[model samples]
Each structure stands twice: as structure tokens, then as C-alpha cells.
Target: MTHRLALLLLLIWSTPLRAAQEDPASAALAAMHQLEAATVALEEAESARDRVRAYTNTIRAYETGLAAMREGLRRAATREVELTRRLSAQEGELAQLLGVLLTIETAPTPVLMLHPTGALGSARSGMMLADVTPELQARAAAMRQNLEEVQTLRLLQKNAVRTLNDAMASMQQARAGLSMAIADRTGLPSRFTEDPVRTAILIASTETLAGFASGLSEIASGDIAGMMASISDQKGSIDLPVQGAVLHGAGKADAAGIARDGILVATRPRALVTAPTAATIRYLGPLLDLGNVVILEPQPDTLFVLSGLAEVFGKVGEVVPAGTPIGLMGGEAPQIGAFLSLSGEGNGPERSETLYIEVREGDSPVDPETWFRTDKDG
Candidate 1:
């Protein structure tokens, strides 16, 4: 048992340590530090010259930090289980080692050295004990290290509850600040204002998404200005307006067998949706069966239709900059206890909201995936 345990301990101890994956407790600690910075930034957002931009950035930071914390916690939990399983496997051998330590600790040195086989036997036993004593000590020390780590991980997880709660509270504050800032924001140029009467008439006349999109070109009440920067060079590299997984690509049929000319993205609840490029807001509001729609005219003829927003920002005619906050995906934010439960059970955030995206170039449906970067992310 001692030989086997010693070999196992040596194998584990000699394995080269790589820093590719950071220590879990350290990662969680780093995430806590990041959350603290985000909280500080949120406090300063009210006085920022561009409050909208400041709040937007702060919210993004919180989202990132929280995600990191989730990841770090998951890793810690997994590693803790692994260390525990290994230590438990050697419990029997360790119990015997505990007995040896206690024997020497309680008995005098002379009594421990005496052997039933007399002087030479005692000498041989002493030498053998000396050799194995260091191995036993090393095994106990290895077990101690693992025990300490498991205890540390358990304590970190226990304390993570407060950290997560505080981070979530600060995120809510950031979101509120962002909403207020957007309300006070101004100075965005308008290409053409929406004529209420014409838009109303068009909405009543059109039953399909394609027809409504086609009618937008003729419904604007004012003169259309020159187009924004051409994104023709940026094909296949534009960032997705929101962080999500593409549920259905263009023309992909749903369970009902109805295929749409857009991609459906599955996003986590209340995830921020930003403008992918510098574009003029053509229209925003509920339309037909779509819950909420925001149409963007990036160029003269090209339009990007984003549907299913809980709350849309910016006016129909205002030209917003790229990466500006446009809207938020719907669904209630998870409560702290529920979030912790999810962190314990899930691999990542639960995507409970869906966003519909369609791209039209000169009244013709085009593949949005061709223009936007769809690379995988954590």
C-alpha cells in the first residue's frame, strides 16, 4: 500500500504544471476585481460627458465580468470534485499512514525502535522505517495540499454568492443609467422623418414582412440624404448586433415548415443589442405578428431588419453610430439564487430570447451571414 501510494503521489507531483488554464480560485478572484472596476465605472458614469456611451460601456463590462465569474466558478467546482475523488481513492492507505504518525507521536523514540527479532532485526527495521518514513511524510503532505485546495474552493464558492449579488445589483444600476442617458441623448442627424399617415396606411395595407420592407422606401416624409459608409468591403467581418447563437440561418425552415429569409438568433434574456454599423433608423415599433421591429438603412437601398426587441432605442430618422445601443432582448433577468443554480447546473447562460434578422439589398433578400462575422465565442 505504501509503495503504491508513494508511486501515485510521485506521478502526480512530477507532472509538469502548465499555466494555459489559470488556477480556478485565482480566476474567480480576477473576475471579482473586474466586477469592482465595473462598479466604480458605473459610479462615474453620471458625470461623464457622453453618459450614454459611458453607461453602455459599463454595462458591457459587467456582462463580461459576470460571464467570467460564472466560468471561473464552474471550473473551480469541477476541479474541487476531481481533487476530492483522487484523495478519497487513497483514503485506506492514508488511514494507515495516520496510524504510523500517531504511533511515533505518542510513543518514545526507544520504544518505537525496539523489535521482536532483537538487535540486528531492530537495526534493519530502523533503517527500513527511516527510508519509508520520508515517503509517508511526503504522502501526508500531498494529501494536505489537496485538502487545503478543496477547502479553499469550498470557501470561495460559499463567498461567491455575495460577489454575484453585488455584481448583479451594479449591473441593474448600469442598465438604468443607460436607459436614462439614451433618453437625454441628442445630436444624431436624420436622413428622413417618418410620415405618420403614410406609415399608418402602409402598415394597414401590408400583411407580409417583405411587403412592409418594400413600402419603407416610399413612406419617408423628408428628403433622403447621402448614404453612410459603404460596408461592401466589410463583407463577412461585421460583428453580430448582439451576442448569441444563430438558431436558424436564412431560408431555414422551422417546425411549422415556414421558411423565412432571415436568421434567428437565440440570446440570453436582457442581453444588449447594438447597431452593427453606422446606419439610419428607418422605422421602429410593433408591426403585424412581429413583436417589435427596428429597420435600419445603412446605404441608399440596403436595409437590415431586426425584429423581436422588448424595447427599441433611437428615432426612425436618426443616424446612429456603429456599436450604439439599439435595443435589449426580452425576458426577466435571472434572480441571484436562480442564477447560482444555473451556474451550478449549466455550461453557460440560458438563451431564452430570440431575435430575427433579415437583410435586404434593393428590395431583394440577401444572405445576412455573408455580411456578418459569425465566428464562435465562449
Candidate 2:
């Protein structure tokens, strides 16, 4: 009976001893330590901006380390179960031995205590068996606790891996987009503003020139209707009126024609014409105070024209689009003109120089200011 008890004790004691030797918790503990250290390094690198690559590398390293740790824990768990089964068998055997020893003690013929050595050995053996049960249970609990902790850590590590990968991708894409924006310098002039201006000129108006002449004829008597008749009514190219180039000095515009000498010889920049969508003045001429003028009729009722350039694009009956650069300021020097026409008064001096840009819905000239976007501020 004593021998059997001694064997049981050995088995129970060895179960925990074997676990201690293996140190099942060591793998999980080491993994956590590595994770902790790596996380700290990652944060530091992110703060410095100098170690982003290293930080990414460390994150991947953490994943590899964690995976290895989990594998170790799985192996340890298997060992733990084997140890637990051994412990159970040893415990059952020990219980049976103890029952046998108690039965001998309770016999009516009081059994004499065995020799000191034998009794001491039996007592020591029983104590050993008893001590190993709690120790084994405690150690098993500790190992299981460590296993659970490792499982939790595995979950956390997985989340961390995903989050870091997403962050890296986002950062890379942001950098690429910034690079693209820097490459395109949109809407800027091709040449420097300091470059000398260039221009082209085309003369097309006959009625405008005649009206200009009629306005200039202050000598015409009352109403001046009969005098205008002598200018001819031919609408064709036949009997084309002679064209004149008059150079005047800088001046202002009011009611009677270009004030004195307001015309300055200019080279004026080219005009860009776009398709029309609204009513606008199709063409204007003779670089006036504003410059050579041309109106774009995008709609039937609206007339839009610029009057500060020496050149105009598109002629009568020509269609232009919206927002086309119709004309630009062009001049070797500044120049100006005026468009004035009298109403009830017969070529009155007060009404001859007052140039008006009007919008006509049907037959009337409306204020042009309502629709014009002036470069005054531009």
C-alpha cells in the first residue's frame, strides 16, 4: 500500500514539475513584451516622420512574431491537457492507497505502528501526494490563464495589423494626389505679362463709318435727314465709301463724338470670339475710348460688346460662343472713342458725344450695364 501511495505521489508531483520545466507561459509572455516594445517604437517613428518606412516594417515584424507566439501557445495547450490527465490518474490512485491505509488503522486488533522508517516513509509519501494536488491545480490554473491572455492578445494584434495597413495606403495615396496637382498650372497665360503686345486689324463697317461722318458734320442744318440721303442707299459693295484712318490723342467720352483728340494709335491685342447663346452686339468698330468694340448677341434681346481694343473678332452674321475672349486691351498707347446719336433734338451738340451701350429687347436700347461683366475690377 505504501509503495502504491509513493508512486501516486511521484506521478502527481512530476506533472506540475514537467509543466514548470516547459514553462508554457513563456512564449505568450515573450510575445507580449515584443508587442509592447514594437508599439512604442512605431509611435516614436510616426512622430518624427523620419521613420515611416521603419515603422511599417516593425508592424509587419510584429505580425510575424505574434503568429509564432500563438502557435507556441497551441502546442502548450496540448501539453497541458496531457499533464491534466496524468494528474487525474495519479490522484485517483493516491485516494485508493489512502483508503487501504485507513482500513488497516481501523482494524479491531490494533495494528502496531510499523518501524520508524516505514511509518515515516508512509507519512511522508501521503504528505507528498496531498501537497502535489493543490500545486498541480494551481499551476494548471496559471497556465490556462496565460493561454487565455495570449488568445486576447492575438485578437488585438490582428486589429492592429489591419489598421496600420489601411493608414499606410491612405498616406501613400494622399502624397500621389498632391504630386498631380502641382504638375498642372491651369489657366495661366502662356507668356510673361512683360512681353510686348501683338495685334491684327480688319475694317468691315460702312454704315458705322457713315454715321460717324454724319455725327462729325456739325455743319448740317436742322433735322439733317436730307443731308444723310446724299450719302447713298446702296446696301451692296458698289460705291463703297472711302475709309480714313484718324489718329487722335488721349481724351474722354461724353455726348458729342470722341472728345476733341481722344484717339491714340494702338496695336491692340487680338480678340477671341465664342459662339453666341444670348442676344448681344455682333460687332463694333473704330477702337473707341474703351477700345475697338464688338458686341456678342448670345440671346435675341441682349447685346454684349467690349470697347477698348483696336481689333474685333467675328463680323455681322458671325456666331460666337459664350465666354470666348472676344477682345483684349491692345495699344502701343492708350486710345478712346464715343458713340452718340441724338433723338428729338436735331444733331444737338449735347447729344452728339454721349456714347451709349444699350441692350434692346425689341427695338429699344436698354442700359448695357445690366448684363456686362466689366474688367474694371479685373
Best lDDT goes to which candidate? 1
Clashing pairs in 1: none
lDDT of 1 by residue, 96-189 (tens): 9999987867888888779999999999998998898888899999999999999999998898888888988888888888898899888988
Local distance difference test values of all predictions, in order = 0.81, 0.35
Show where candidate 1 strays beyond 4 Å: 1-20, 104-107, 111-127, 255-257
* After superposition, candidate 2 runs with Cα above 4 Å error: 1-22, 97-378
Error of 2 at 140 (Å): 15
Q: What are the models' TM-scores? A: 0.87, 0.24
lDDT of 2 by residue, 148-227 (tens): 65565455444444444443343333223223322331332111111111111122222442232222223222331211
Model 2 lDDT, full chain set: 0.35
